[model samples]
Target: MKPHQQGTERVITSLDWLAVLPVGLLLRQVDLTGCGPTCITVSRWRPGAGAGGLEGTGLCVCKEDGAVCGSDGRSYRSVCALHLRSWVSLQSGGERIRKAHDGECKLAPVIVVSPKKIHNVTGAQVYLSCEVKAVPTPVITWRKVSESPKGVKLLEELPGDRVNMAVQVRGGPSKHEGTGWVLINPLMKEDEGVYQCHATNMAGEAHADGSITVTEQNKSKKASLLAWDNPS
Candidate 1:
């Protein structure tokens, strides 16, 4: 076998980046050597949104300056893997979502849970399940949106803590796991917020949002008062 000759390679430039960044982010380009031919991908970063990876968006075939490009070819620029995600998310919307192709990636469904709204002057018991999902199965989290109303009792992850609640399971991961289930021994006003189920994987990340409401436990309140004795 004979040795092959060397050729010149350029740096991927800032202009190349601008072509690839999400609709909003300013495009930056840098010159660099490019792989021969590849299925290009788009990604994005929304202000308050979770991660939307590059694989789930558009794919463009990129080639070396003089390399043979693939058929069904469209124009594209070079982008890094991280920034690529931001580009993908923005591109993924109503119209683009319907388009399916081997070259393009599909985003998983996004869930926004708005938990039932209720009010309670007295303590209460409640069973609430956060919104759920399959792929990159979601994990549950707790938060307090409003101030704690008096006489309210909450089964928080821990006293004085609002995050890091362990995921309670009916069956193991083999049978079933990672489904969002939360218990409120005595629900209270403090236990109200957007309980979010965040799902993630190599594909991308999304969240399921649900609100929490605490209804009054009148019976428990009465029993507590009856049990209390006046110091005076």
Candidate 2:
């Protein structure tokens, strides 16, 4: 057989050399010399070209005036931005989307303005209220500063029932505020002392004090004289 001259030929042994688009689309196959239309994937290009990233796409505008701390431990410029970020993440099949909370993430304990000192006569009902503001919602406890070294006791931990007691502790009717303790029926002299309110949370603890003065009950002079003169 006579040998016939043939044109040079090329063979693409693998698709490994194909460039991968950011959205996971493979480039079109072509001859090694390279002359053909590029394969265009509308769906894959849509995400990278003008959709889904955190920047641009009008995804992070500050719709409202409040900032928030996301569960990811970062502060978002605004609530709208946070929600938008979450939506993008969910749409992109990224990590689970976490929406941010209303206020900046913080833990602070503050005692509202309460009377510095309160006076009540024997057998009078008095309420010593302490309002606390704290993140994570603090636990409210009332204690009396003791003259002895035994320290104070949580009012709820006091022995026996509070049905007939010098003091009783309770929470506020609404959780939006806080709690307090009441001196239900104070004794003439026994209940006179300094009381403290203790608030605790994951961040730490805080306390405030108020003085309670109990005055001696007054006895009528005529009744005293009559009792002395009668000598039953």
Off by over 4 Å in 2: 1-67, 70-78, 81-104, 149-163, 166-176, 219-232
Q: State the lDDT of candidate 1 residue by residue for 1-232, as single tens digits.
A: 2222222112233333434433322222222232212333333334444464222332233322221111223222232322233334446651211212223232343443434544444345554554433333434454333335785643333224433233453322331124455556556656656554455544465654456655356765776787785433
| Top model number, lDDT | 2
Give the Å error, residue 67, model 1: 34
TM-score of each: 0.32, 0.46
Model 2, span 76-160: residue lDDT tens: 5454445445545667786654645776555656776453688877777766778876666777777666554566443433213
List candidate 1 stretches off by more than 4 Å.
1-109, 112-114, 118-121, 145-178, 215-232
Superposed by TM-score, candidate 2 places the C-alpha of residue 53 at a distance from the truth, in angstroms, of: 30
lDDT of each: 0.39, 0.53
